[model samples]
Structures are given as C-alpha cells and as structure tokens.
Target: MANAFYKVPQPVNEPILNYRSGSPERKALKEALAAYKKEALDLPMYINGEWVSTDNKVAIHPPHEKKHVLAHFSKGGSDHVNAAIDAALAAQPAWERMPWQDRAAVFLKAADLISGPYRARMNAATMLGQSKNVYQAEIDCVAELADFLRFNVQYMTEIYQQQPNSSPTVWNRMEYRPLEGFVFAITPFNFTAIAGNLPAAPAMMGNVVVWKPAETQIFAAKLVMEIFHEAGLPAGVINLIYTDGPMAGDIVFSHADFAGLHFTGSTKVFQALWSMVGKNISKYRSYPRIVGETGGKDFVVAHPSADAVQVAVGLARGAFEYQGQKCSAASRAYLPESLWPAIKEKLVADLATFKMGTVEDFSNFINAVIDERSFDKISSYLAQAKKDDGVEIVAGGNCDKSEGYFVEPTVLLVKDPHYRTMEEEIFGPVLTIYVYPDAEFDTMLEQVDSTSPYALTGSIFARERSVINYVTDKLSNAAGNFYINDKPTGAVVGQQPFGGARGSGTNDKAGSVLNLYRWISPRTIKENFVTPKDYRYPFLEEA
Candidate 1:
C-alpha cells in the first residue's frame, strides 16, 4: 500500500487564559506554583535519550524571589559537549532518512502535548523560574511555544512541496536534505518559547542538535525535553547540555563536522563565536551555516497627535513586562513637547499602580530582573542617570536587592538625543525620553534612527494619517518588527515574523519558513525518459 499523504491542521495561536482571582486557571496555577515551590528538581543532562549526570552543577532560583531554590542541573564541560557532538553525528543519518511525514508527526504531537497535558507545567515553570507573571508566562510558555511547534510542522510540509518545473521529455526532482553534520543551538534566558524553538526547529527539519540553554533557564528547558520525549521523538535526535558557553563554542566552532549554529543571545557572544569560526574556517569539512538573532535597543516614538493614554499603556506594557528583558522591549522614545507633559503624567500614574513582588501574586505587574549581574548593570545605569547632568529620573529609580534583584521601572528625560541611555541597550525596564518641538517630528525620527547601532523592534504612535505614513517611509530601516499603534514586544509566531538587521545578528525570522530553510540543503535530480543507443549528445554535433 502506498503511504498516505497527510495535511496538518492549520495552526492558530493558543489563547492566553486570564488568571483572575476566582478563575479556574488562577486556582490551578496557584496550586501548581505552590506545589512546585515545596519541591526542588534535580536535572540531569540529556544525551542519546538518556539522563546523564555530572559532578559540576549550577543552582537555579526564581529571579523575583531569589532565595527560593527551584532546581539544580548537571553542568556540561568540553568532554560532555564532545560526546554530544559524537552522538548527534552518529544519529544524523538515520534521523534524516526517516520519511518527512513521519518526522512531521513528532513535532505535531509535541504541539498537542504543549497545548493539553503539559500546559500547566510549562506555564508555572516559566512564571517561577523566569520570574514572569501569570499572563506573561501564559503568552510565552504556552501560547507562543505551541505555535512554533504547530506552525513549523506545516512549514516543513510547505518546504517539501516546493519543486522546480520540468519538461515532458525529462523529470526533475528536488530533495531537501539535512545538513551533513550536526547543529548547535545556543539559547538565551529571556523567552521560554525561544528555548523550545531554537533546538527543536533544527531537529524538526531532520537535523540532529546539540542544545545548550542559559543556566537560569534550565528549569523550563528541561521540561521542554520532557514534552518532546513524551511525544515520541526518537533517541539521539536532540541532545541537551548545560555548560560554559565559551567552552562549548571553542570546541564546536573548530570541529570538522560542525555544520551550523542556531542561536539567540547577546551580541558580544555571537560576535566572539563568529570570529572564532572565521579563524578556523578551513578546518571544517563544509562551511558552517551561521543563523543568529541578537541584542536590540528598541524604541517608541510619539507624534504630536498621539494619544497620551495609549502611549502610556504602550510604554508600561512594552518596557516593563518581564522586567523589560526582551530584546524587542522599548528602550528609547521621542515625544513632542506638548505630548510629553501628558505622557509623563499618565505614565507616572500607571507606574504607581503597578504591584511589584514575586510571581505568586497574580496582581503584580512587574517582577525582578534575571540575575545579580543584570541587577547590578541596571542599577549602574540608574546611578549614572541620577548623577549625570544630561538626564532626569522621572518615574522610578528605586533598587532593592535585599531579597530579589528588583529595580523600579525607571524613566529618564534627556536634553540630548545622543545620551548613552538613549543609545545603549539596557535590557531592563528603563526608558529614555527625548522631547522635540512639534515642528521637529521629522528630525526627531531621523535622530531616533541614528542614535543606536541596533535596530530590532520599534513603534510609532500617531493619529494623523500623513504623519504615520511619513514616519513609516522615513524610518523604514529602523526596525525589523515595526508596530503601528501597538507595542514592539509580544510578536506572534506566524504574524510578525521577528528579526532585525545592522548591529543585530542575521535577520533570520524565526517562526517562518526562512529560518527552517537554514537547516536543509537541497539536491536536484534529473532523468531522461528516452535513451539513445549512441553516447553522442546534441551538444557534440557540429553546428
């Protein structure tokens, strides 16, 4: 019997469940959080479908409540990374040879698992471990992660269906082959969806992966491993590691079989890795494919006609959600002189209403920054703002690390558009405002474009149609993900297609077919229907 050609259901985004005080979702989540708090998980490195333990360990804690011990994971070293690469190389041929439909089923099943049974576990883990509130956790851990899995399965089929046209006398077929060797996925700590998508995206395209996640994110990343295993992903397809990133990069970048890097992290590390790869370019059997999405100093701009209430809400939600740790979070703003007063008033009121504490409280809108390093960095910026003559701390400037790494959502008003806070990426809940005369909106737009090296996400708020069109056309290269009247953060998987250029890493839009294409190499096969008795071809005949 011929194999059945199956079509996956079109993926719609998972809806965020409102965890209101009396709601069922809230009660269930509260119970899950409480249960998780009492128990500490011991995580082992995953290799060749087996749990491997090591003497080196790192403890993970909730960023909002730093003293609470959540989990500890076995740390990987060069030896472990080497073993992982070997295992992935051994598994690559078999995994790639499996039928495409069969491969699609595994990821589709993983989406189902995330949508159903694994929902609570994923959300709760992100809320506690990553210090996101209930709503933020729901959107990232449950909704976006499931969307990547579901949509990527459909995308894989789409990639397979595309083929070249052929003439009647001959047949042309194209094969989408996995890369010759293994992919190394280096993930960041900001998003749970990214943690799941980075490694699985490559593996879904039939490439074996040696995955390493940020230490702070191991709690949720380990859960992602469980979901894939339950969905019947075969052994050795994706090997998860915990280790020093530099050490792993040192070994993997120089290896003969190193085929690609699937990464989302800081710009500094990505650049360092790129340099190392360049230095060892000749050592590899084939040139490695480099795909990465890195840091951004995103912005929000208000025209004279913009609404103060909406602008205030956008800045609050965009800049403070998850403590503004997202690469797409708004870090700078350009406001008209008249609009600044109202925006300042409304933003201060909104900041006053925010309840800051642990994620266990559903009412708290803000949480702690990621770790001590992040805390110190943000605090240093606040200190500089307080001391410098170029700025004023308008809304929030409090920092308390007695319990958790908490910094108040701060705003700085700058006379100079080129101030350091206006250009640098703080990666926290700090926004710099530069006010311009109402006549200088165009000039301000240009200044906003030129102030920062990064161009990841940005937004423009204007009710005037002409002004909107003007900014849209003028700031065309300002951001990869541009917003109309909305916030730059919270990009839906299939909708916005997130990425950026300039100082940003390669604009490989994740959650799209472009990103998946990186993991596959194409081969063309042609056959002639007619065979000639003689070996002479038409080209051999004299004209």
Candidate 2:
C-alpha cells in the first residue's frame, strides 16, 4: 500500500571530467581504452533480461581504426523483434503497476553507476566504437547520460504532482497513467547518451519499451543495457534487440497494441515511420504518440558587429566536433562580407592546429567518420565543391580513407547562398560559408530561415543588443533551440529543454516535464462530497 509521497533525490547536472594529461581520470580512461582494445567482445541481444545470442553476428570496428575488430554483435531478425514485443507486452502489467518511486530508484541508481564505477568503461567503449575523443565521450556517455536519468526522474515526479482544482463539494485529482501498450525506441549512432535515454525515458514513465539502437552504436549500447540491468531494471521493461529496421518496424507499427514511438534519427526515417503509423492507425488500440528529433542543416550566422574571435571559435567547435556527426552540428554559416576576412583567418588557424588521427591519441582533435558509407557521402560533397566554380575551398579539403574513414575538416566558401553544400546536411566536418553584404543582415537572416527544411538548432552571433533582439525574433521559427552567442551543439539536459518544431521534430522538449507528458495518459477523478437525493439542478426548483 502507498503510504507517503516519496520525494526523489534532487537532480543535478553531472559534472564533466577533463581527462588532462597526468590526471587520475586520464590514467583510468587510458587503462580502460587499452583493456577494450586488447580483446574483441561477442555481444548479444538483451531481451527479457537475458543475453540472447545467434549465429548471425555482425563485426564491429572502430571508425578511427577500421583494421582492428572491437566486437561482433549477434544480429536478430523478425522473430527476435516479435519476441521482444511479446516480452514487453507480457511485462507491461506488473511493470506499470510498480510504484513510481521504485521506478525512479532504478534509473537513479543507473545514473550513479554511470557516473561512478562504470564511467571509464562507458567512455572507453564510446571512444573505441564510435570514434569520440576523451572529452566528447565523457560529456556524452557519462555526464549527459547521467543527467538524463536523474533529471528525468525529477521531471516525472513534477508531472505526477500536477492536480486539478477541486470544487467545494468535490475532490478532483489527475491520475497520470502509463500508456496502454508498448513503446518503440529507435536511437541513433552519434550519441551514446541518446541511445540510453530514448528507451529509458518511456520505461521510467512506466511504459514497456522495445529498443533498437543503430548497428554502429551497439558496442557501447551493450554496456548501457548492462548498467540498466545492474541498476535493477525489471525483465522485459526495456528489451534491447538488434534487427533490420524495416523488419522491426513492420511488426511494431502494424501491431494493435503499439502505443508510441520514441525516435532519434534522420528525417526520412522518422517520416517513413510516421507514415506507416498513420496508415495503420485503425489497427492500434489507441492513438500512438510519435516523438522524434530528426535531421538538421543547422546554421551559424555572424553579424558585422560580432567579434571575429568569437565567431571563429563557435564555428570551429560547432561545425567540426565529433566530425560534425551531430544533428545539431553547424553545417552552414552566413558571414557578413565585412568580418569574413578576420573570421576566415582565425578559423583557418584553428583548423591548422587541429591534429587528426585515432581516438587513442589524446593530442588528436579530429578522428574518422563513423563508417565508410558516411565517409563516401561526405567525400562526394567535398569532390563536388572542388569541381564547382561557384565554391572555393577555404581550408582543409583533403580526405584519405586508406587506413580509416578520414576526411579533413573542410570549409567551402560558396558563391550561391542556396548552394547544395549550404542547404543539404553533409553530416561531416564540413562547413559551408556564404559571405553576404554587410548591410544585408536582415536579408541574410531571411535566407537562413528559408535555406533548410529543418528547424532543429541554429546560432546567431552579434554584439549589439538591437541586432541580437531583431535577429532572434526574425529567425524565431528557423530553429527549435536557438543560440545567441554560443555554439548550438552542446545542449545541457536540465538547462536547455531541447527540441524543435516545423520538420525537425514534434518539439516535445526532452529534459523537461513536457517530454514525460507524452508517455502518459491522464484521467481526471472527481468525487462528490455530498450525495444529492434529487437528481435535479437548482434551476429545476422553479424559483
């Protein structure tokens, strides 16, 4: 029986560890990385709290060192997808019935495990498997993942505390119930934090989940499931399966009990899933909630008043970090003709200083792209830019994939604002800059707003308050998470409730209470204090 309203531990953002040379964290991380590199793991599908293996194993290789094998994950098919869904459905009743505090405890413990003992292992996995540098891996897999877990618990409690106003004769309350069926969580490859959070969010809200992580991400994802299991997540609460996307979607989307989708991937995939759900709407037990954070041709627009150094730094970090694989990475920039020269000089200097190599080398700022496919795609863009008369290679246009998928941090100065590189998402360490007339800041803002179909993230750099205010309002609909002076990439969990509307996603604002609301169905309960003998209103008294 429920006795008290349990207050969860106050949520705080997990502090990022700087693995500087000679630091204990650096030493520990180095040891972990070496350990991971020494052995090749045989990973398995986590279903119903069991490690399920199969003969169909896919080899995993580090993007920065593709010659070496890191792990091989057992890939499942339609049968495994069906089995995962079945496990989730079977576990739904007891899992949902579990106390919210108990549910919160599970993830909270997972958060602690992530930040404490499991931190280095997680970071090492991300570095080796996904080609993230030490700092990037720490911020992503450890700090950010912990933040999502702890902060989401706080958000869930806040959601449950919301109540309706009660009348003098009636007591009214709002009950936030978990959804009728299971949730499907399709996570991306770039962020291990996202891979962990996508399924964990809905499961924390008392919903069962069938999680499908990208093949490229499964190496670290295995560690995530292990941490969840260690933290006491119940069997079948979150069934992690490896399978073909379309095959899994066919079963999940067409099922009558399909409840919702928690997705982070490309715009095309999200749209296709949405369409499939729409087509099969009649088959579902209830309206399925679709929440997605999709693709972006994110921009960084600089004003003449902006400091050249600031703009340069923003572009350097925002556009090139993690090889610009982030959906929020700044792929396009519009610089004023007045400040272009200084910005260009500083940006080129920064690019020149960046050392590109394997993630094992802490001195290297740049690493390989995720795979050969991404490498080829990005190389094609660079190739076209080199051939086109309308663009100039400003700096770093070299690509050598002889050893690994290495594409140099490239910059293109485009004559046309709507050039293919400027409008399209390159998803690599490539930034396309278009120099507009210094006097045409307003026109450039309009162009920025209209250039991309995505409204995910964008940044505007200006010193003047008037220019900042005007540009902010003008490009209000251009980005979901807009930045004034900072880069658009590192959105903190509790601080920035991240999401965007108008093709980017549903803009449910993850890291806030808004996202938790999506996984629940609320029912209002009203009990009359006094029973009326007559079934007539005051108007029936015939005054």
Candidate 3:
C-alpha cells in the first residue's frame, strides 16, 4: 500500500481544561513558555557598522506572564546611541547619492531574502518574543515585512518618476533631492513589520537610518539586521540598536546631523520626543522631520441588516488577534438595540469557542500579551471595571500570569454609553459593548466621536445603503483608517495608507506615498537648457 499523507495539525477545540491540562502539544507549549521565562536568547546592539555586545541585560517576558523572562536583551547606553547617530551621519551622503534604481534593487533583494527561510524564523520569533498568535505572527513579522519592502520600492519608484505637468517647457528639467542628513526611528513591539518599514522607508530614499527597537521584541529586530546584511545592504547605511528610552532621546536631540525621526509607540513617547526637538530647535542646522503613529481606540458599529456571522468573526479576530495589542484593534463596539442581543449572543458563543493557547498551537485563537507591563495594564483595567457602576463583564475576566503574560479574552457591557470603560484605550483582548437605541443612531455616532480622544480606526457593518453612506460621512474623520463590513486591520502596503490623526499622532500614513514624501526633501532642480549667458526670458532683462 502507498504511504498516506500526514497533514499538519489544524487548531481545534478539545476539552483541554486549564493551561495545565492539554494534550502533548499543549504540554510542550507550557514547557517552552517555562523555559523562555528563565532562559532567553542574548541579543546584540548594532552601532557605527559594528555589532557590540553589552554587559548590561534586561529581561523579556512572554505576554502570558510577567515573571517569566523569555529573553535577555543587551541594553546600550548613550555612547552607543551617539555612535549610531554619527554612523548614520557619515553614511547619509553616499546613500543619498546612489542611483535610485540601485537603492530600489537593494530593497527588493532584501525583501526577497527576508521572505525566504528568514521569513519562517521571523514568524517563530514573533510568536515567542512578542506573544502573537500564528496568523498574526505570520502576517505582521514575515509576510507583512516582505510586502512592505517590495511594494515600497516598486510604488515609490513609480511615484518618484510620475511627477506631473512638465509638458510644453521647451528648456526645463526637474529633479528631487534627498534629505540632507540622517533619519532616526523608534518602533514598538506590537508589529515588527512596522519597525522594519519605519527605517527602511527612509533608508530606501537614500537617507541613512538609526533605529531603536523596543526591548520587548529585540530578538526579532536583530533578525532584521541579519537579514538586511545577508541581502548585501552596506554597513552603516542602516544601523539597529537596542537601548532604553532616555538614551534614545539624548542621541536624537543632540545630533545636529539628525534630519528626522519615524516613530511608532505610545503617545507619551512621541510627546517627549517632540519636546526634545523643540529644545534643540535653535541648535539644529535644518528643520527636523518628526513623524509618529501612536495609540488608538478603534470601534465597530453594527446595524440590524448586518450579517451577524461576519460581524462576529471580524470582531473576534480584530479583538483577539495579537491579543488585542494593535493600535488598530477593535476595543469598543456599538450595536443597535434592535440587533444588540443577537450580536451579543453570537459574540459570546464565538468567544467561548475560541481556543486559547501558545503560538505553537496552530489551532490556538489567542496568544499571550507582549510583556508584564501589558499584563499589569490589562489586569488593572479589569480591576477598575469591577468597580464601575455601569460596567459588567460579559465574557472573560480571568487572568493567569504564572507562566506567561496571558489574559483570557474579555468583553465588557456598559449600561451607559458614557462610562469610563467606553472612553479609555484598554489595549488588550478586552472589548467594551454598548447598545444604542434604534432612534438614536445619529446621537450614538456623535457619542462615539466625542468619547474617543483618539481617532485611529473604526468599522461600520450594515447592508443598508443609507446606513453605510451616513456612517461613512460622519465617521470619516473618526479614524485615519476606517473599514466597511470588515475589521480595521490588515492594510496593504501600497494601496492603503496607515496611521491616525488626533491623539493617535501625526498622520504620516506609514506605507503611503505621503510617508515616502516625508523621508525626502523635495528640491526642484530646474535646469535651464538654454545657456544663462546666451539666452534670456521675455520677462527678464537681457544679460
């Protein structure tokens, strides 16, 4: 008889009791989580074309638990940060002067290399280091990284050449200039892809980059450095460093050669960086660019005609994917009173059926949070919800941080739409639901706009034409990225711009043409074909 094909195991719901009581797969995940807590890969910091090993170490925890150290990351001081800045300064001119086609080729090769074997390892690292689920890890760290590089190069090359309205100029030529100096980048752990592109975007445009990746995801960031180098990127063109926040601040502000910063993190961090820029405003040789994408409190609105199955699945994936740590994750939902009970029933049923396990468990729907800080924050939010008069836990309210930074998927129902639970950004697998009276549709939208200090992202689910049109117009400004009948994540690199306005930081939409524009300083090099001494314009006096 022919040998049978052994297919890979798909994620399924078994009667696995708690974290301790599952099959051998679950047992292995537990073991890995336990081992990672105590023993982690030692990551290096890069600067000035050298990978420096540091003696000082910091602990990394799987989001399932805070006490467990998933990895030990090397921490660099101000000296290292300054060295990277200097390296970026030295490399900027050459990188800028390189032909655009060459730069595009380099990034394209890098993307291909990353998507190969490097892609698998990257996905695994994201799962362990950042506590992302299988699909989330695959997309954000591996797939999305490749896409960001490839599309940025292809689309940017096209945009660079597609400048408009040069016709009928008998003796005129136009050219664009790269920024004068180095670009600095500070990225977060939520999406390693964002970290890669924040600096890659500027570097591809001929600017040298100094990147400070979040300590939580240092190992993955280090992998990026390895992949770029393997792809033949010149040393000093893109420098990656691991450091504390203050050290990063000192370097970016003190370096007179620094031209810009591409940041994705908390709003507080952006504010502090902005303050430093202001302090050094007079000392800098040129105006520095500060582009940021901070926090968000995204929403979802459901109308009666909306497909309950579709909305439930989208909301479940949006709320629980990456353990709801994304800036675009849906944390709040508004359901019309007529459809509220049915939606609630489906959501609860979906939530109950979701299998929560380690990323190694391909069937697992939700993985751990990123770190202990995330656990504490989400835990604190739940504690606060217990005391809130109008808030009730509709789904999960339990947390287990003994082995990893893990919190069960949680849903909160608010009796009053104006409750605190509805306003704050509870960045985790926590969703707050509120019912809107059918007659109060307009009023509810106004409430959504007013309640959220952040206007990062929101979704509307309705089959009715009028409902869709009305919500789109009213909530247009509600999110930098708004969705219709879909979850507010998975934005493609070239087609849709990413980033948010209001408290979500500067609207420098990450993968869009607008973002590429930020990386370059447009200098209109108008070349006059006619010799200046031999020819003169009709409006000017003859030389």
Candidate 4:
C-alpha cells in the first residue's frame, strides 16, 4: 500500500549535559545510580518480543566495585541461539514489508525516549556496569546513543529516496530492498551506544537482527532492549540473546539464512568470523555482507612549532580517558626532542591531579579497565616496561586489583620509536612516548606510517600551515579519522563518520549513508509502455 511521499524529522546531535555541582541532572543521576545498586536484577534475553529466561545465570559486577553484584543475566546455549535465529527469519518478511515511514517512527520514538525519560537510568547503568564516570556515561549511553538512533533514521530516508531515470516511453525504478535474511550484530563492552547502533542500524533498514552484546556490558544492554520495546518496536524485529561466542557462531555462520553481519570488536575475532563465513559461503542463500570496526594503535604527533602545553593536554586527555578503553584512544606519541622537556613537565603535572577510584566519586578522572582479563594484560605490559632498559617509566606505573581492576595511567618513554608498546595495541591507560630529533620530522612521519599495521585515528599538532599540510599529506594512509590540533577520539556522528582500514576495519563509515548501503540489496526495474507487434528491430525491418 503506497501513498504520498513522507519526510522524517531532521536529526540534530543531542546536547551533552555537564553534571555540575548540585545540578538537577547530577542529583537525578545520583538517585538513579543508588537505585540500581540497591537491587540485584535478574535479566533475561529478548526473543520474539518475549523475555526468555534460563536456569543458567551469570552474575554481573561493576568493574570498579567487583564485590557488589549489580545483576545476573540468564545465559543460554545452542537451543536459544537457534530460537533467536528462527524468530528473526520468521519476522523478516513482515518487517521488511512494512512502510518505511512506520519503521522510521519506531526508532525516532526510541531516540526521544532515551533523550527524555530513560536518560538517567541508561547513564547510570553504563556508569556502574561498564565502570565509566558520569561524564563518559552521559556522552555514551544517553547523548551518543540518541544521536545514533536519530541520525540513522535520517540516513535511511536518504537511501530510499534514490531512484533511476526514466524516458517518455518507459519507466525505470530502483528499489532498495532489505537483505535476504537476518543480520547478526555483535557488540562490544566499551560502548553502550555502539551496542545499540550495531543492531539498530541494520534493523532500521528493514532487516531483522539477532544481537549479541558482550557479557560485561549486558547490565546496560538490558536497558537498551527495554527502551526499544517501550518505543513500540515490533515483535521479533530485534532479538537479543546471551550465549557463548563459539556456540552462537557455530550455528549462525552455518545456517542457510545467514545474510549479513554488523560487528564491533577485536580485529582477531572479526578475522576469525570472516574465515568461518568464507568456509561456509556456499551454504547461504546469498553472499553475506560483513561490516566491522576493530582495534586501533592510535597516535599523536607533535611538530617543533606546536605548543608544549597543548601537546601535554592532548596526551593526558586522549590517552587516559575512560581508562583508555576507546578504540580511538591515543596509545602512542612522537614528540620532538626540543619540546620533550616542557611536554613532560606539563604531562606529569596533569597526571598528578587525576583521581582514580570508583565512578561514584565525581572528581575521579580515571577508573578501572573493563575486567580482570584486561587488567592482567595491561599489568603485564607495565611489568615488561619496568624491566626493559630501553624504556623509562615517566609517570604513574601502579597496578592494584584487591577490590577492583585498576591500573594507574602509566607513561613509558622509549628510546626506540619502533618499540613493541608503540606498535602493538595495549588497550588500557598506557601511553608510550618516543622523543625524536626535531629535524627528522619527515622521517618520523614515515616511521609512524610503517610502525603499526592499524590505520584507525591519529592527530598532528603544528602551528605553521606548511608543516600542517606536509604532515597531513605524509600521514594520509596512517589514520582514517585524522585531526590537525585536536585529540583523535570523540568523533561525533554525522560530523566525522568513524571507521578505519588496513588492519583496523572495512572503513564502512558508520553513522553515514555508506554503512546503511551494506544492509540493502538493490534491484532496478524497467517497464515498457508500448510493445512491438513483431519481434524485429528498426535495422531488421527495411534498411
């Protein structure tokens, strides 16, 4: 049933709220956090619009306060995964056939709900569950999640409006249809917004989804499912499940209805999934669309002309925020020897003022890493750096996990630019600095490009316009989202579409129309207004 053309409401980025002292938002957020901590919730999986529970329960704990049990989620096995896939496939036809405007309305309502009534709860969940400070939680769980939902609806409209040209005698049209089967969305623990976006993006494009969120993130992810339901999302459109990765992959990848994958996780896991898909390609109905955003060894480079204070602030904020869990976090830096002394002074001074503790304390700038596994990995790196004569610990090299998994924001000054910590990904609050001669800036740029297999995010600081231009061009392939004088993190949706290439990801540019294009299969149709009586052309007639 087709009617008049409709337009969705224009999307604007949600304003970030600063939880100032005694502010209403701060008080409300405090109450929400206290309320969540008072009760230990029993969470369940959402399949076919039903909350499915099992006897197998996994306790969820705050990364910074491991003694407190926040929630316990029901974990399922192969049967539940099969049920989720079956539900998605069964729901696919009705969902894809619905009017695009109606589908857009569901997500738009979800955005409004997140922005208004559910904002505090969502933020609180993220703060306690993922061990994020209030500021980080507000930006991620509330503002960024709402932005993704709203902006994605706008992107979907732009996609459907595209059509082909037609002549007077014939009519042509291009129909953007949803992929043949369900999409598998595998989300990570670091970002609640990403968890929502990975599944919601594909589902908004008229495709059904089976979403699997990270175990550490399910505490907040359960709230995401609730918000979607309250927004009037239809049954089975998006089915959230909790199962072991290998068990789920074994069933999903081998199924005939496997159509597409929207993933945000480690690069190695993405590669393994791709390999599995390739081996089972012949079993599927159509070629599955694989889109992923993976790891980053992000960098920050400073020119001799760059201000020392600004460089220090960039390194402090870019490398240590959110315990350096962000994929785009600056893990390595190249500072000119001329500016090293001043930069080091300011950086150390700034690190001295950072308070590390649980998220309940608003003043703490640093918090725990995601879990014990991350803590061990980061601690091992710190231990190695301490013993290595080639590197010197400049500031904050402490690890304590008696109550929570916490590693102090550690800095390593390495003599060699190609040291292991500089090239490899240590996804914690550890920033490695290498001081190079000021005259060898170009050589350093070349080394930067070759140092890491990742091309995620990077920043170059320079006052001179020529130096800026020269470095920008030289490091063209070094990063996907490059900055001139700012930190490489905090890429806003619609402003800087985020992704990377080489070893990082497919660079599909999430939050843009480009990522939406992957979820659709286009078909061009041509209709002839008049038919020829005889099977003959003008050349065959009477030339």
RMSD of every candidate to native, in Å, equals: 1.5, 0.9, 7.9, 0.9
The residue-by-residue lDDT of candidate 1 on 277-364, one tens digit each, is 9999999988899999999999999998999889989998898888989999989988899988899999999889989998888788
**Which ten-residue region of model 2 has the weakest summed lDDT?**
534-543
What does the lDDT come to for candidate 4?
A: 0.94
Q: Distance from true position, residue 193, model 3, in Å?
A: 0.4
Better of 3 and 4 by TM-score: 4
Ranking by lDDT: 4, 2, 1, 3
lDDT of 4 by residue, 39-59 (tens): 999999999999999999999
Clashing residue pairs in candidate 4, if any? none
TM match of model 2 to true structure: 0.99
lDDT of all predictions: 0.89, 0.94, 0.79, 0.94
lDDT tens digits by residue: candidate 2, 36-104 = 999999999999989999999899999988899999999999989999999999999999999999999
**Which sections of candidate 3 miss by over 4 Å?**
1-40, 65-70, 163-170, 532-543
**Per-model TM-score on C-alpha atoms:** 0.98, 0.99, 0.89, 0.99
What stretches of model 2 exceed 4 Å from their correct place?
none
- Give candidate 4 misplaced runs (Cα > 4 Å): none
Q: What is the lDDT for 470 in model 1?
A: 90
Give the runs in model 1 whose Cα sits over 4 Å from its true position.
534-543
Work out candidate 2's RMSD over C-alphas.
Answer: 0.9
What number of clashing residue pairs does each candidate have, in the order they appear?
Answer: 1, 0, 9, 0
